[model samples]
Target: MKYTVLSLFPEIIDAYFASSIMAKAVSRGIVEYRPVNIRDFALDKHKTCDDAPYGGGAGMLMLPEPLGRALESAGARQRFVESAGAGSAGRSSGRVIYLSPGGRPFTQDVAVELSREAELILLCGRYEGIDQRIIDTYVDDEISVGDYVLSSGEVAALALIDATYRLVDRVITAESLEEESFSGGLLEYPQYTRPEIYDTLRVPELLLSGHHENIRRWRLRKRVEKTLALRPDLIRRGEEIGLFDGETRKLIQELGGEG
Candidate 1:
C-alpha cells in the first residue's frame, strides 16, 4: 500500500517508517511512504504554518493553504491514476484522511478495510487543528485514534498506518489475526512461556497436558472470564455477532458468566 502523510513533523513519520516491521515492508515493496512537510508549502519566510483563529482562540490553528498545497502536490497525481482505473472519469475513492478529535473513531474493522486500499493520504493536524474549509474541500474522511486529544496528529497517523499495514496480505500470518484481541470481539486468552510455574502461579495445566480439546475448552472459558471481568460489553457484542457457540455458551455458564 502507498501512504502519503502530510505533517509539520515529517521526521517522526520518517524515523518510524525506517524501523521495525515498517522497514521490512518497505524493503519488500509491500508498503510505501511519502512524507510531505506542510511547512515546506508555507507562504512566509518563517514558514509559518499556523495562525490565530478568526474567532480568537487561545492557540493558533493550522493554516489551510499550506496544508492543502502539501496534500494536493503529494496526493493529486495518485488520485488521477486511481480515477482512471476506477473508470469514474472524475473521482478517486482513494482516501485523503485527516487525523483529528472531531472524527469517526478508528477501530480494527476500519484497519482491515484500509488494508485493501492501493493508496492513502493522511493529513496530520498540528497546533489547534486544521481549517474546516480545507477539510471540507479536500479530506475524504476524518479519523480519531481515540477519545483523548494529542499535541500533534503525526503519532496517531503513524499508529493508524502501522495497524492498517499489518493487516495487509502476507504482512502477518493469517492465524495471528484470528487469535488476537478484537478479532472476535473478545480479548485474547492469556499466554505464558518459559517457566511452567512462577511464584506459585502455575501455567494452566490443560495447556501443558497435551490434550488439545481440553486446552481449547480451557482457553475459551478463560476468554469469557477475562472479558466478563474487564469488558463485559465485548462478550455482549460477541454474542450478538454469533462469535460464541454452544460450547462457548456452556463454558461461560459453567464459570457463572452472564453470556
Candidate 2:
C-alpha cells in the first residue's frame, strides 16, 4: 500500500519510514510513502499556516488555504465536487484520513480494513487543527489513536501508519499476525524464551513436554486467564458476539468460578 502524508514537519514522517521494519518493507516494495510538507504550500512571505480562530479560541487554528492546496497536491478532491459528478482528472484515488481527537477510535479491526486499501492519504494537522472546511471537502475518515489528547498530529499519524503497515501482505508472515492480542478477541498468552529456568522460575511443564495439543490447550487457558484479569471487557464482548467456541466458553466459566 502507498501512503501520502501531508505534514508541516516532513522530517518526522520521513524518519519513521526510514527506520526498522518500515525501512525493510519499503526496500521490498511491500509499501511506499510520500511526505508532503504542508508549509511548502503556504503563499505568504512568512509562509504562515496558522491563524487565530474567527470566534476566539485558546490556540491558533491551521489555515485552510495552505492545507487545502497541500491536499490537492497529494491528489485529494473536494468530496462535494466529486459527488456532483466532477471529473477525476489529475486526481489520485486514495482514502483521505484526518487525525483528530474527535475522530472515531482506531482499533485492530480498523487497521485490518485499511491494510486492504491500495493507497491512503493522511493529513497531520497542527496548531488547534486544520480548518473544518478542509475536513468537509477532502477527508474520508477521521481516526483517533486513543481517547487521550495529543499536541502533535504527526505522532498520531505515525502510530496509525505503524499499526496498518505491519498488517500489509508480505510485510510480515500470516502466522505472526495470528494469535496476536485482539486477533482472537483476547490478549495474547505470555511467551517464554530459552534458559528454561530464570531466577527460580521455570518454563511451563507442558511447553517443555513437546506435546503440541497439550501446549496449545495450556496457552489458550493462559490467554483466557490474562484477558479476564486485565481486560474482562474483551471476554464479555466476545461472548456477546459469539466469538468464542464451546471449549473457550467452558474455560471462561471454569476460570470465572475459580476467581
Candidate 3:
C-alpha cells in the first residue's frame, strides 16, 4: 500500500519510514511512503500556515489554502472543485484521511480496514487544527489515535501508519498477525524466550513438553483468563457479535466469564 502524508514537518514522518521493519518493507516494495511538506505550499515569504480563528479560539488554526494545496499535491480532489475540472491526476483513487481528536476512534479493526486500501493520503494538522473547509472538501475519513489531545498531529499520524503498515501483505507473516492481540477478540498469551529459567521463573511446563495440542489449549485458556481479567469488554463484545467459536466460548465459560 502507498501512504501520502502531508505534514508541516515531513522529517518526522520520513524518519519512521526509514527505520526498522518499515525500511525493510519499503526496500522490498511492499510499502510506499511519501511525506509532503505542507509548508512548501504556503504562498507567503514567512511560510505561514496557521491563523487565528475567525470566531476567537485559544490557539491558531491551520489555514485552509495551504492545506488544500498540500492535499491536492498528494492526489486528493476537493469534492466541489473536481466538477470544475481542477482535480489532480490520481484524484479519484487515494482515500484522504485527517488526524484529529474529534474523529472516529482508531482501533485494530480500523487499521485492518485501512490496510486493504491501495492508497491513503494522511493530513497531519497543526496549531489548533486544520480548517473545517479542508476536511469538508477533501477528506474521506478522520481518525483519532486516542481520546486525549496531542501536541503534534504527526505523532498521531505515525501511530496510525505503524499500526497499518505492519498489516500489509508481505510486510509480516500471516501467522504473526493471526496470533497477535485483538486478532481473535482477546489479548495475546504471555510469551517466553530461551534460557527457560530466568531469575526464579521458568517457562511453562506445557510449552517445554512439545505437545502441540496441550500447548495450544494452555495458550487459549490463558488468553481467555487474561482478557476476562484485563478487558472483559472484549469478551462481551465478541460474544454479542458471535465472534468466538464453540471452543473459545467454552473456555470463557470455564474461566468464570459470561461468554
Candidate 4:
C-alpha cells in the first residue's frame, strides 16, 4: 500500500513512519509513506494558507487555492491510476479521505476495507477546516476516529494509518493479526510473559499446562468476560451481528447474562 498524507505539519506524521513496524514495512517494500506539506504549495511568499471564515467563525478556514494545488499535484485527476487502482476503501471508486469530527465513525471494518486499497490519499485539515469546495471537488470520504474533537486532522490521520497499516500484506503475520483486540468483535484476552510469578502473583496454571484446547477455551471465555465488563456495547454489537457462537452463548448464559 502507498499513503499520501497532505498536512500543514508533515513532520508530525513523518517521524512515525520512520520507526517501528511501519519502518520495517517500508524497508520490505510493503508500503510507502508520502507526506506533502500544504504550505509548500502556497502561492504567497509568506506561505499563507488560511483565512477568516466568511459568515464569521471561531477559527480560520483553510484557503482553496493552495489546497487545490496540493490535491491536484497529488494525482487528484488520476483517481487511483492504472497501476494502483486504489479502490474506494473497497468499492470501485478511488478516494481522498478527509479526517474530521463530523465524519462517519471509523471502525475495524473500515481498517479491513482500506487495507485492500492500492493507494490512500489522506487529507489532514487544519485551522477550522478545509474549504467545502475542496472536499466536494476532490475528497471521496470523511472519517472520524471518535465523537471527540482534536486540535487538527493530523493526529487522527496517524491513528487511521496505525490501524490500517498492520492489516497490509506482511506488515504483520496472519495469526498475530487475528489475535489482536477487536479482531473477534471483542477485546483481546489478557496477556502474560516471563516471570511466571510477579509481585507474588503467579501466571495462570492453565497457561503453564501447555494444553492448547484448554488455553483456547480460556482465552475465549476471558474475551467474553472482558467485553462484558469493560465494553458490553461490543457484546451487544456481536449479538446483533450474530458474531457469537454456541459456546459464547453458553458462556454468557453461564455468567447469568450479566456483565
Best by TM-score: 3
Per-model TM against the reference? 0.90, 0.94, 0.95, 0.92
How far residue 167's Cα lies from its native spot in candidate 3, in Å, is 1.0
Candidate number that wins on lDDT, 1 or 4: 4
Residue by residue across 1-259, what tens digits does model 1's lDDT show? 9998888989999999999888998999999888899999999999999989997859999998897688778754222224344542343445889899888999988998888999898999888898888876677789999999999899899889989999988777898888677776767899999699899899877788998888877777777788888988877777777777788777667777675
Ranking of predictions according to TM-score = 3, 2, 4, 1
Residue 95's C-alpha lDDT in candidate 4?
A: 59
Q: Return the clash pairs for model 4, or none.
A: none
Per-residue lDDT of candidate 3, residues 63-160 (tens digit): 99999888878878767655566654335488899999999999999999999999989989887998898888888999999999998999999999
Write the number of the candidate with greater TM-score, choosing between 3 and 4. Answer: 3
CA RMSD per model (angstroms): 3.9, 2.4, 2.3, 4.8
CA lDDT of each candidate?
0.83, 0.90, 0.91, 0.86
Tell me how many clashing residue pairs each candidate has: 0, 0, 0, 0
Model 2 C-alpha lDDT per residue in residues 53-171, reported as the tens digit of each score:
98986999999999999999998987766556665334458999999999999999999999899999999988788889999888999999999989899999999999999999899
Stretches of candidate 3 exceeding 4 Å from the true structure: 81-91
Candidate 4 ranges beyond 4 A from true positions? 78-94
CA lDDT for candidate 3: 0.91
Model 1 score (lDDT): 0.83
Worst 10 residues of 2 by lDDT: 82-91
Candidate structures ordered by lDDT, highest first: 3, 2, 4, 1
